[model samples]
Target: MKDAAFNQLTHARRYFEAKSAVYDENARGWYGRLTDALLSQALDLSVFSRLPDGFRFLDVGGGAGRWTERIATANPESSGVLLDVSPGMVRHAERRATRCGYAHRVRHINGDVDEAGELLAGMTFDLIINTHHLLGFFHSPDLVLGSIVPLLTDHGLMVSVLPSRWHAAFGDLSVGDAERARRSLSGLSWEAHEAPYGHLFTPGEVRMLHTSSKLTVDLLTGFPCLIYPDPPGVASPSAESAEDFLRDDTFFREVLAMETELLIDPDAGARGANLFVVASRVQPAEA
Candidate 1:
């Protein structure tokens, strides 16, 4: 019999496979665009600017190569690998990379992160990107991190964006009462949203996880600190309508600027729907 972790991974792979055809279209709405902007800016400020020439990078659980493509395009001299458990996602990423002219710079692998040790044997990278709450799906995230950290060069970086419990408690989508939200958050277990399952973490939990893996946290930030839930009687927009809403550049830019400001405030920043972390592998001290 398959273990729970294996079963969850199988479900996740199937979920992403079914959604691969509509993934890009579904991800272009206002929220997705804003999140992408925030992530890109964070990468520029932290990782991309400091990368050495001919750097090697890896994208774990990179669906459709969205973030991988961005990194590849930004660093044309750098080569990288895109790994995902879903074959459909891997295929889409390969096709996109080819069309975007970065095909030669990136290799797509259809494999699981849990098996990184065997799947990526004898390979290491200068940087690794894991986002969209990739760690939360794993049965033992610590083991997953252990596998990944060894793949990084000394002082190498791993950038991740994960769901935050604080965000769910305080953001616009919250239940509007802190204690109640906390109670609700505590009861969550592998709930499915867009994917097969997800888990949320606190900022402190995230820090502890990295530190335990011998990685030092370099930066942590939360996005969209202020969230305004839709008013009563307002209907949620469909995918097409949401995309149309994002077409207004002026409105979009203004909202993003507001989020940028709020994201800097420690108290308010912790209320974002996601937490962005930049962690570096610690080098051993010279004897």
Candidate 2:
């Protein structure tokens, strides 16, 4: 890897390492619940449900093995490998695997995606899980994708959740920052949360990435489209208020139902805060 790229990865590693202790804390909130609902809905698809016994999986950029453990636990016969840049996260992932009593079925690698080719050399996975804006943090998403795509078997599938380019743009507009919004729409980095290396993507852009990697887009949609619903007589809801509203069991259920339905919208990819994709390696034509 180039020195410049390596330096960026170092920065990302430090950021995640600092958050590793509380990495899974986000899963405790209403948004976390909504995220779980949508991802669970996606995993229910036939492609994931019908995997053969003893299938191998890889969780790229999976911190603390939250989703990795979930998937591995659900498929008792399957084994998994989790690769992350932060050693702290990898340590937590190892502990989770042991606590879940599947230590033998899983392994953890403390390395960046830039070194994935060397680290995961000669191994192919039936399922590759990349979630939580993993692609956005990369300086060269294409390079990372290229490295990982080859590790996917011809019949393998990759499930990913990437930050939506338009979502970031809309977020800027919501704050009345027309300049930032314009930059976002023009494909400039929004520098989200002061992370300069972050790069969001449009649906079309993601599809093109798959095409270039010789992968087939099996499913693509947006998730959690209804993040903050307006309440009666209120035009703008603060984060606390939104959380309080979603805390009501009935409202939570209703919102989850609505978000699940939004997954089917053709334009959901463009409309959603995050883009959910399930793609597979292109199969060779039969003679």
lDDT of each: 0.74, 0.79
Model 1 lDDT at residue 7: 42
Error of 2 at 132 (Å): 2.1
* Candidate 2 Cα RMSD (Å): 3.2
58: Cα error in model 2, Å = 0.4
* Lowest summed lDDT window (length 10), candidate 1: 187-196
Worst 10 residues of 2 by lDDT: 228-237
Which pairs of residues clash in candidate 1, taking residues 3 or more apart in a chain or in different chains?
A: none
lDDT of 2: 0.79
Give the per-residue Cα lDDT of candidate 2 at 8.
Answer: 62
How high is the lDDT of residue 215 in model 2? 88
lDDT for 244 (candidate 1): 54
**Candidate 1 residue spans exceeding 4 A from truth:** 1-7, 169-184, 190-192, 228-247, 262-269
